[model samples]
Target: MNWRNFLAPYAQVVEELKVKLKGMRSQFEYESSHSPIEFVTARVKPVSSIKEKMKRKNIHMDNIEELQDIAGVRVVCQFVDDIYDIVDRLKSRNDFEVIEERDYINHKKESGYRSYHLIISYPVETIHGERKIIAEIQIRTLAMNFWATNEHSLNYKYEGRMPEKVRTRLKRAAEAAFKLDEEMAKVKDEIQEAQRIFKTNKESDD
Candidate 1:
């Protein structure tokens, strides 16, 4: 089948999934921000080209109706614990079926990275009919995402094979980013505690 013919239907499904996920994320942010939990931002990306390449390789994208992970959503959180909390809430939704999950935090990547990924099947009713589409959800802290982005860019520039010096530099950067994440987490807790104390003092004075 031609690329256009193969992708048209899937593209529509992906767009619908993006809209739904965005709406869900907005609701989540609103509800969580009021509490001690920090709000997170969601990003959606379509992997149609990657799926097409898999087809060329004769890899049967699981559930042809739901070509695995053609659409992706990334939820970036502030703290490590928040990542798990958000994933739990998302998994609890009846509209989504978690197909697979990977926790890269506890087990860091060789490149010294961490993130959580969830491959989920989300049902969307389109003009064609009800279609279950795969959406990969990635959850990570801001620091982790920053490190990953830099490493990804460098890897792409070097076509996955970089000079030893550049590789070492990236490794150093990753370590620095890890430390930065820890420090930021500590600062965040301190600020939250101060805010609570201020609120308590104001209430007492009143």
Candidate 2:
């Protein structure tokens, strides 16, 4: 099968789904006033031939559609807990069907990385008909996403296997990222409380 031929049909569906998911950001924000919610971005990435090679080895490449992982959406939240809350709300939606889920936050990888991933099937009505495409949604704190971006680049540069020393360094960096997230959460709480106190004092003075 010529996989490239399939891209066009799916690309349109991907764009439509992106718009729908982007619209949800405002909804999430209105519900979670303590923090900002934004659609990180969305894209449809073609699966590299190297990925195909890895799939041949029991790694399980589910479908040609599944290969385009960036097809759907990425929701970036201010806090780690917000990521979970957003996922809970998304899972409850009738329009989405959860196909697969991986919670890397609680079960950190050996590399000490963390993020939550969801592969969901949602129906998109095209001129042809209603097609259910599987889109992968990744929810992660801003810090986690930054660390992942750096780690991905390093992995690509090292051809997927970094030297032992570099690997150790990356693991340490991941730990630092985890700590950064915790500290950020604490700071956010302090700032919120301070703002509340200021508001109360201003109202009293008035």
Scored by lDDT, the top model is 2
Q: How far is candidate 1 from the true structure (C-alpha RMSD, Å)?
A: 4.9
**Local accuracy of candidate 2 as per-residue lDDT tens digits, 1-206:** 46565555556656765676666775644564354454567766655752644465434545444353636577787678888887887789888698889899999999878999998887877667887777788899888888888998998798777999989998998889889889988888786677568766887999
In candidate 1, the residue pairs with backbone N, CA or C atoms under 3 Å apart (3 or more residues apart, or in different chains) clash, namely: none
List, residue by residue over 2-43, the lDDT tens digit for candidate 1: 655545545665565566656766675455431323333333
- Predicted structure with the largest TM-score when compared to the true one: 2
User: What TM-score do all the candidates reach, one by one?
Assistant: 0.73, 0.79
TM-score of 1: 0.73
- Cα-based lDDT for every prediction: 0.69, 0.74
